[model samples]
Target: MTDHETNETAAEVKVDRQRPETPSYEEVLFYERKPAGFWVRFWAYLIDLLVVTALTSILVKPVFALVGLETSGVPWYAPYAILSALIFYGYFVLMTKFFRQTVGKMIMGIRVVSLKTDDLSWMTLLFREWIGRFISVTIWPLYWIVGFTPLKQGVHDYIADTTVVHEESFRKNKLLQKKTPDGSGLHETSAF
Candidate 1:
């Protein structure tokens, strides 16, 4: 080849290297993400409270009976509180790690996601569900931050760098309602 031809080929190669590959149709179809808001999260949490209360009651009853603490006039605070904490941590951590949501969140059509990865991790689950939730429950006002934050993040979400999102919207490949890289929120729509 001539010198000019070699130069042209090199430039073509450089251009090809600089161009970004377009995403596949499947990726475009499956990767849409959307954030869940306060009202929905609140309703889901109420449902979760009922579910957890029932579950805790059931589990505690057997333990109380085994410990011979179920008799009338027995003080219930100590075992109840300890078991409640364990149940809360276990329920949140296990369910969110495996299912991406609690029973309540699932019923409300929501899911939790780690901002760092596609799949949830044990550390994230522990922080978000165990420690972060403890803080939020102790300081009840922290939970209300979900109402004012852009992504509806609460103390637990902030601590874990996670978010709650609308499951169907995410699953259906709809456009996300979160802030874009340029920090814009003006383009969110509900096509579902």
Candidate 2:
């Protein structure tokens, strides 16, 4: 080919190889739903504990009184203690399983969401509320881990792959625009 013809061919190739124009920065407005923090969760737990105590008092105390059974000075292995423990664990397990939140959580406007599955399962409830809660209750300090974790996950939350989130609440999140693979335009994905 002649030099002039070769130059024209090179120009055509350069034009063909030109990438599409894309914006460098794009401001995206979105809502990011944050998890329930430590204080809120603490208040909810306190409320639940009060409810459990009230239930135990109203339900078990009267029954023990009727039967003339001693309510005080009972060991952890005592029948009253066993029944109370059952009520405590059962309250959490059944409430979480059916409502996805306990009464306290409902009052606090928070709910548990399963991360590993679309819906909460029986096994998840058992693991989170019964076994995992048992550990948290025993250690107590493990509950504070929520304050430090990125997702505000506690021991039970980590074990169950669940997170507590505010119902019907969100914070505005601004994300920088990311370039598309073909450099066609800016792209943004929802934080959810």
Candidate 3:
């Protein structure tokens, strides 16, 4: 290389290292994600629940009707509980891992992210969701409260170190409304 080219390269390299660090607020603006609050998260949650319910109902009810199994030997509520569990859990796993949100969340333009980083993974999604079903259901009559909890985290979220967050617009709207990621006014912290 020519001497002039080498000098220019050296000057650029030095300038790169001398750049000042961006502050936390700047990082938050750029990255530094926060969890969604209860209800906005709830909106997404309700969407998922509704979708899952509609789907499983569509799939299961017809089969029962076609085969006359509704009252053949299987009970009505039994199918609802057992089938709902499988459908909901399966739907939760698929959407959270692959799509990073359910149909409702997708419509709402919200997604879940890692607690510290703004990324998602299958393992993270699986563990967080499985823990969600186990802990939230086992602890209460319904897993509904998880949607009401701060960060929209239920008991399992505590175990998984995960948090649900709304889309960027939702968070900004939340800040403006003095509401939560879910649009609730609840003041809360993580399980820790």
Against the true structure, whose TM-score is highest?
Answer: 2
Candidate 1 residue spans exceeding 4 A from truth: 1-31, 70-77, 170-192
TM-score of every model?
Answer: 0.66, 0.77, 0.58
Expressed as tens digits, the lDDT of each residue in 1-192 for candidate 2 is 899999999999898789665546666888756799999999999999999999999999999999999989999999999999999999999998889999999999999998878799998889899889999999989988999998899999999999999998887778777667767886765342
Best candidate according to lDDT: 2
lDDT of each residue in 102-176, candidate 3, tens digit only: 888887777767675666666667677877667765777455656566666766666667766657644321221
Models ranked on lDDT: 2, 1, 3
lDDT, candidate 2, equals: 0.89
Worst 10 residues of 3 by lDDT: 22-31
Query: Which one wins by lDDT: 1 or 3?
Result: 1
C-alpha displacement of 76 in model 1, angstroms? 9.4
Point out where model 3 deviates above 4 Å.
Answer: 1-31, 71-80, 116-119, 138-152, 170-192
Give the lDDT of residue 186 in candidate 1: 40
Instruction: Please list the residue runs of candidate 2 whose C-alpha ends up more than 4 Å from where it truly belongs after superposition.
Output: 1-30, 173-192
